[model samples]
Every structure is written in C-alpha cells, then in structure tokens.
Target: MKSLAELAEIRERMKSKVVLREGGNEIRVVVGMATCGIAAGARPVLNAFVEGVNRESLTDKVTVTQTGCIGICQYEPVVEVFQAGKEKVTYVEMTAEKAEKVLQEHIKGGRVVEEYTITHAKKA
Candidate 1:
C-alpha cells in the first residue's frame, strides 16, 4: 500500500494466482453461494470441497470457486464439477459429506457420482 508500483505488482500476482492458465487438464468445482444457496448451507459444501481437494493433495489438479445463483432454487446448495474437455456434472442438494464423496470418487477416480448429479435426479 506504499506506492502505485507496489500495488500493481500485488495485483499482478493475485491475477496470476486466480487465473490458473497452465496445466492442460484441470478440475473446476463451482459452488453456488447466492442468498438462497447460503441459506441452504452452501458455505459448508464449498468449504468441504476445498478441504477435500487439499486433503487429497489435488491442489494442482482442482480449483474450487464460488458463484452466484445457479437458477435452481430448489437445489440451493449446488455444486458443479467441470473437467477439461468433458461435460460438466451438476450435483444438487450438496452437503459436506456429498462434496467429500465427489472429491474422492469423481475428482480423483474420474467417476461421476450418478446419485448426486442433477441429471440422474431428473432435474437437468
């Protein structure tokens, strides 16, 4: 906060860390954190995913982020997993437990948990 030059450098560093342009294949876990989602317990779901990724040492392979409304209020605590060159998997009604399972079975083992996915629940 001393000078504009220092501020610019800090901004650049933050941008680079958030952008994550390298690594050909990466997994993105997006948690909806809109008002409805928050009221429905999205924060814990998001935290769980972050912890799971770190616990499994998949930091380089997975990026966890938060988003606004996902347009499905009934499924407020929603999570979507997107892997490079593959279809997105939307998991509805998420909890910390479910998020952990997703991290283990899906992110690490490359298998989408059908039971948690929106498609399997006939809501996609």
Candidate 2:
C-alpha cells in the first residue's frame, strides 16, 4: 500500500499481457496437462503455445489454457484446437518443435498439419 500511482503503473504494464476470453473471435488452444500428459511432455508444448502467441502478436485471438486428462493415454501430450464454427482438431504425441509448427501453420495460416494430427499414423 504505497501509493495509488504505483498500483496504476503496475496495471498499465500488465495490460498488454492480458487476453480476455469473454467474447470476440477467440481460438481456444487447450493442452492436456494431466499426469500422463506431463510425463509425455506437455509442459514444453504449453510453453511453446504461450510464447509463440505472444511473439506473433496473436494473443488477442488465441487463448492458451491447460486441461486435465483428455482420456487418451496413448495420446498423452494431446493438444486440442477449438475455433468457432469449426471442428476441433486434436494433435497427438506432440513435441516442442511440433508445437511451433502448429502455432505457425495451423494457428497462423489456418491450415492444419495433417502429419502431426491424431489421424496421422506413425511409422513403425
């Protein structure tokens, strides 16, 4: 409780980093962060989405959040993309590098990378 001016200054600094989810054209990026997801490395994927959105100035449109188990253990590190009036895209077995591609291509360019998606069959 120093002064009102200091509090106001802090608020101003934080304003740029805040992304509201009330309304507007919001694209929801939900990362699975349950135990399996963590063991399979969801932290980096989550970080990638957050940092990528901030870097590309897409924070307003994209809302990155974490969720519990998506119930598909084999796809532990799953990422689900939800946009209005569009089918949700589920990305499985994600890595930090793959997360970057999703951020750059799917989130930015609007084209989902089929290879990284749930439908893609991994080679033996």
**Candidate 1 lDDT, 1-124, residue by residue in tens:** 4899999899888786656646543888999999999999999999999888889878878889999997998877999998878999999999999998988899999999999988777744
lDDT: worst 10-residue window of model 2: 16-25
Q: How many backbone clashes does candidate 2 have?
A: 0
Best by lDDT: 2
What tens digits encode model 2's per-residue C-alpha lDDT throughout 1-124? 6999999999998776554533564699999999999999999999999999989988779989999997898987999999988999999999999999999899999999899888784442
Clashing pairs in 2: none
* lDDT by candidate, in order shown: 0.88, 0.89
Candidate 1 shows a clash count of 0
